[model samples]
Target chain A: MDKNKSINQSANKNESQSENQSRYIGVNEWKRHGFQALWALVTNSYLLGFIQGKIYKGRLKNLCVPGLNCYSCPGAVGACPIGAIQAVVGSWNFKIAFYAAGFLVFIGALMGRFVCGFLCPFGLIQDLLHKIPFPKKLQTFRGDKALRKLKYMILAVFVILLPMFVVDILGQGAPYFCKFICPAGTLEGGLPLVLLNKSMRGAIGWLYAWKNAVLLATIFLSILIYRPFCKYICPLGAVYSVFNPISVFRYRVDKESCVDCGVCAKVCKMQVNPVEHANHPECIRCGACKKACPVNAIR
Target chain B: MSRVFRSRRIGILLMAAGLILMGFGIHRGEMAVVFGKAVNICMECIGIG
Candidate 1:
């Protein structure tokens, strides 16, 4: 009877302890911060979304927050790194995105998926949308080992190279990704701009139609799949991922405690073969696996 | 026989259907209606709508 009492007491104690830990994986309440405001700037271009409260105070800076924000967002007090790079290219300016690059490096070194999990507006948008009642899945490397490298190609050629090298007849550089390829730009800036301004409608051509098609496809995919942009495309995610291995807030796997049952792998949205490399660059570090582990092996 | 292949085949067909719908709707849907109204109203305006 004494032994039975002791066991029950210990179980209750553990239950109580788990209850007290409010900051555990999914229970944490989101508090508004720099990420939201910055996200608004990156994702929306409305007049209300514009006029950032901080812009008047001279807090404008680049790449500082290490998320994809729209430079053209009305409330933007500071310039977006990608937009800055494009604008710099357009203007034939040398070293235009230096500040943005510096900011990305600094934040990335401090915490890797800390940005992906917390700071990125797009990531937040996907997570919330995913909560809707639907059968969801997480896919892994199937065929085409070469296919995964498409994002890197986007980064090298589409995101960086063409904008820097290819010049318009006016000898000006333009944000090619934003104008031609970026679904984020289309969703955030292009749609809003065209919607509000009647005159901008006539400017609609093949380019505008192309941007709309990409935006529509992304939205459709996001409803079914988990973060199609972040998974297959996002050049910004690719950049920040490089520093994941060394980042301060990293996912550490205690292999000895791990049962290798693939429970963690099954839950991961990024499809990181956690058993191989826990802190894989693809890990947005949503901590679903950490919570899912029966033995609490994944940290 | 191949799961991914089947999905892709269906997906491509869906995409083609979607394009046809969008093309037709571009000339007739709500978006088209809005665009048509805005365009017809202003004969010379050549910008955003």
Candidate 2:
């Protein structure tokens, strides 16, 4: 009877140990999903807009959030930094765009691409789309590396130069990137407002058609690739990447504990090799690589 | 203090300076223009302007 009791106790201990190991396996996934959900809530918190179908135009509209929330979205309370910057640049009486520029610099210096990894509504949308069980396109071609520089060009040309220089017959500069390339505006503002306001449907022209096509293409690409816009086209992301090396909040690796394993590289969605270039400009600081490290070297 | 802490202090100072600059712009009414633009639905941003 004593022997049988001891055997039962040992069995229970083994079962509990197995349960603990299984619980740990689920912990990382739960933490990631929880963070995403919390950020989504924080980003889209103007709940009254969905019910009333009107934008909140209070003092909050003056301040810009770190994430890429559309300023024109009915649910948006805070202003968009990119749109604000473009407006300031396009203004005839433009002095320096100090407010917009300062806000961008502050956010970038503090968090770097942490904003892209966790805060951006469009980035979250892309992340969800990429998880939809389709075969992903991971391997990069020769042109892929060169094409990655396109966002900087877009920033220089559309966001900066065109807004500052390209003027109409009336000598008024236009926000060219917003008019031409921003899929966020199409998804958040155009589609929502057009669906809500019946009168606006008739106003839709070739420009609207072009924007809608861009939105569709972005959505399709995001389903196959991870954050196509963020990786290749988001000017805001381009701005943030420049600060990754000098940002206050950044990833740290314990080289002492790291076993030189390539697991982190294998798991990184942004194609960043953690061991070689943990602070690479292209890295979004997503923490997947950190989680993938077997020796718990990254933080 | 460690070099990391010193770097962090510099970053914080830069961020503070940026905020001050933004505050100056607000005093100069630049933020008001940003607010005005944001309050209205941007037709151009939505591909209608």
Candidate 3:
């Protein structure tokens, strides 16, 4: 870590351009490439299951990656959370999946936005796009603490409750977040499937139009905000926050050497306090804040 | 950390191996989607080709 700080001393690592230009290896580089790689997965058949469907669609097979990936994505090789939840709810299925719950807890405990920062291909796309040169507004760090609470409520209500308790006697479950929300699904999942299969495209109507509008709005809004969906929405981030305190790999702060000098906070993409939630769940482990600290107070 | 990397090496290799096996399973008499069809919709759809 010291060696890295020394090398980047003359070079500001915080700039998205510098980071892009710098030859960073390890997990983070994989993230930049992984976002593209999933697209490669769509092209090549390397990890088709993540884009297509999983090996088994059994009762207990839903414990998996959190963010929305299209189960119908031609190259997908795993089960998507929204799809799994829908499958579970549709079947009016067994006990709440202990494995699924545990997986979410485990991810939250580990890197908070590590999933967002690295693992999630969709989140990576937004991060890459945000790097595109443009002036944008950062959220109100001081004034909007209350509204920031909306994400958690969204996690609870839209992501969890509606799917779990709102099942009808007909035993049908809705992909609440995907059907009604989830811009990732709208853009990545829904549109592609429609375009690829003409039948699905021809059948499109009010629902498709509505989702497209949300997708267009989100894409437009993404240019104005760093990550509009990720900042105020994305229930997965809320769930991951639950495990922030004890996550396996997370930020730690050194208070003694520290001035409460807020360089770290200002550059923070997620607007989380590196001092407060050192391993903050909202933090996507983007490394932006760590690189921002002038005194190297954070690690 | 070296130990961590060593273990990760094994784990990644294992994952690679499994993905390879899965690739093999998915590869019976299949022709690659000629890059032409893939490239056309690559950027807007999946963000890469």
Highest DockQ against the true fold, candidate: 2
Please give, for residues A1-299, the per-residue lDDT of candidate 3 as tens digits.
99988778535534543443242222134445556556435432424333432222332222245554544454444455544434443335431433334445545544556666666656766766665666655555465566667888886776667767777786544557666666776665566556665555566676667767877887776766666777677777676666555555657789987666556666666778788767765677777667666567787
Residue-wise C-alpha lDDT for candidate 2, range A1-299, written one tens digit per residue: 99999999888876754553344332144466567668767656777776655677888899998878888888888888888888887877773678988898889889889888888888888887777777656545577778889999999899889988887675557889999999999998888888877777879999999999999999988888778899999999998999887788988788899766566776677888878877788989888877767678987
The Cα error of candidate 3 at residue A60, in Å, is 14
Q: Candidate 3 versus the native: TM-score?
A: 0.67
TM value for model 2: 0.88
TM-score of 1: 0.67
TM-score of chain B as predicted in candidate 1: 0.46
Q: DockQ (Cα-based) per candidate?
A: 0.02, 0.68, 0.03
lDDT of 2 at A36: 67
Scored by CA lDDT, what does every candidate get?
0.56, 0.82, 0.55
Error of 2 at A90 (Å): 0.9
Model 3 ranges with Cα > 4 A deviation: A1-63, A141-143, B1-49
Per-residue accuracy of model 1 over A1-299 as CA lDDT, tens digit each: 99999999888876654543333334332443345545655533334633321111122432123566544433433444455444544444342343344445555655665677766766666666655556754454464235556767787776677767787686655456666667755654565556655666667787777778887787777777677777777777777788677665577788899866566676666777677898787887766777766678887
Q: In candidate 2 chain A, what residue range of length 10 has the lowest lDDT sum?
A: A20-29
Number of the predicted model whose TM-score against the real structure is largest: 2
Model 2 stretches with alpha carbons more than 4 Å out: A1-30, A169-171
